[model samples]
Target: MKIDLSEVGRPQSPGARAVNAMTCDVEDYFQVSAFAPYIARDSWPTRECRVEANIERILALFARHDVKATFFTLGWIAERYPQVVRAIVAGGHELASHGYGHLRASDQDRAAFDQDIRSSKALLEDIGGVPVIGYRAPSFSIGRGNLWALEALREAGYRYSSSIYPVAHDHYGMPDAPRFPFYPNGPDGLLEVPITTVRMGGRNLPAGGGGYFRLLPYALSRWMLQRVNQQDGRSGLFYFHPWEIDPGQPRPEGLDAKSRFRHYVNIGRMERRLEQLARDFAWDRMDRVFLPQT
Candidate 1:
C-alpha cells in the first residue's frame, strides 16, 4: 500500500494531463451529520427522498462532460433503491462505500465500525456488481482518535479511504494529518487520502469540495484546486454530495442558524459551478487516479 507519489503528478500518457479525483457522497439530505440532532434517525425513511432523481441529474451532467467519477454510496440507499447503484455502475463510475446509515466513524467503537464498513462494502458489491475498494467515512470522521477505522477498512478488503480531512473544523478534522495520501498504519497499510487543502498563512486551508465549495466564490475555489495541481504537483481529491445540487431539498424546521446556512448556502448555483469545474480540468475516478496499478 505504499503509493509511489513520484509518478502521481505526471500525465497518464504523453501529451495528456494529470487528472484529479472527482467523488460524490451518495446520501439523502436528511442523513447529513449536522441534522442528526434535529432529525431523528427513525424519521429518515419517512422523510422526502430526493436522492434518486438528483443522482440521475448528476449522471447526465457527468455524461455531458465526459467525466468518470466515484460514488461513495450508503448501504441504506442501495438497499431501497438498488437501481441507483445499477445506474452508477451502468454509467461506468466507481461505486464505493459511504458506510451504512451515515454514522460517524468517531462515534462508533471498533466492533460497530467494523460491522458498518463490512456490511456496506458487501451490500454495494452485491448491488453494483463491482468490487467496492474505497470507503469514505460519514462527515470525514476518521481522525486522530479513530485512526483505527482505516485499518478496519483495510481488513475488510478496502484498498483505500478518503475519510480524513486535514483542515481544522469544529465538527471533524485532524488538522495535523498529512495533506496528501499516506499509509496510516505503515507502508503496507491502507492508503488514506485526505481531502485537498492548500497551505496558506502557516495553516492548511480547505481546498477540497463540500459546503466550503458552495460557500466560497467559485473562482476562489477553483484557484485553490488549481494551486494543488499546478503548484504542489499532485492530484487533488474533490468531493460533494448529490443533495448539494438539489436546491429544493426539504428543509427541516428546527435547525439552528449555522446548520441551516451550511447545508443550504449557494445550493442554487452548485450545478452550474460543477459544470464549470468539469470544464476547467481533467477529472477521473478515485481508483483510476490514485490506484492506477491496481
Candidate 2:
C-alpha cells in the first residue's frame, strides 16, 4: 500500500530548542548493504521497487509532526527518481548523501570511494538544488580503519558526516569512537557526528536508531536518546531507512534467520512509534543541529 505525506503543511519548529538530529537513509529495502551478500546487484532490478511508496509514508509521518529531517539519498535512487529527491527538498527537508550504489566506504578503496562521493554529491545537488553538506556511509562504514573516507568527504565539499557508529557490531562500528560530534581529522578535519551511543559499564552501547530501535521496545529507545541528551548534554543523532516503516514490502527469500529478523522486526509498530517520537521530542535537520552557524 502507498501512503502520501504530500499536501500536508510542513511541521513548525518544535517548542523546545533542537534536541536531536533526525535522519533517514534514502535507500530501498533491496539496497541494504548487509543484503548484498544474499542479493545480487543485477537481481535488484528484477525485485519489486517500493521506495516511492515507502518514502511517501515516511514524508507523511514527518509532515504530521511537522518534523524537518535530513535525507541521506543514494545517487542511483536520485538518478532513477529525481522527483522523489525534489519532493523531499520541496517538503522542507535537507538532502544529504548516502553514497552512490549504497556501497560502504570501508568496502571500497580510495579511488573508488572518491568517485562515489563526488558523483553522489553532484547528482543530489543538481537535482535537489541544495548544498548536500552531510553524508552518512552505508552501514556506518567509515570507522577508524577507513578514516581516509573523511578526507574524501571533505574534498567532496561535505561539511559533516554521521558515519561512525561507536558501538561494537560485526558488520560496522568503532567502539572507541566519540559518542558526540567532533573533528576526527584534527581541527581541520571534517566534522564527525558519530551515531549516538552511551558509554555504559565500560562498553559503548548502540543507542542510535536502526535495527536497535526496531528490535528493542520503543520506551527503551526513547529513554536512551533522552539520556544521551539530558544527561550527556549532546544531541542524539538518530537514523533509519525508508523500508523500516513498510511492513508489506516484498521480503526476499533465502536470507538467514538473523538477517531476516533484523530487516523485518517490528515494522508494523514503526509508524506509531515514530508518531510518539515526534510528539515526544524536538527534532531538526542535521545541518542546523550539528553545523556551526556563521
Residue 148's lDDT within candidate 2 is: 79
Off by over 4 Å in 2: 1-18
RMSD of each candidate relative to the true structure: 2.7, 7.8
Worst 10 residues of 2 by lDDT: 1-10
Q: What lDDT score belongs to each candidate, Candidate 1 first?
A: 0.90, 0.84
TM-score to true structure, per model: 0.95, 0.93
What's the C-alpha lDDT at position 222 in model 1?
91
Candidate 1 per-residue C-alpha lDDT over 103-197 given as tens digits, one digit per residue, 9 for 90 to 100 = 99999999999999999999999989999999999999988787778878899999999998888999999888888887777667678888999
Best by lDDT: 1
Superposed by TM-score, candidate 1 places the C-alpha of residue 78 at a distance from the truth, in angstroms, of 0.3
How does candidate 1 score on lDDT?
0.90
* Residue 165 C-alpha lDDT in model 1: 89
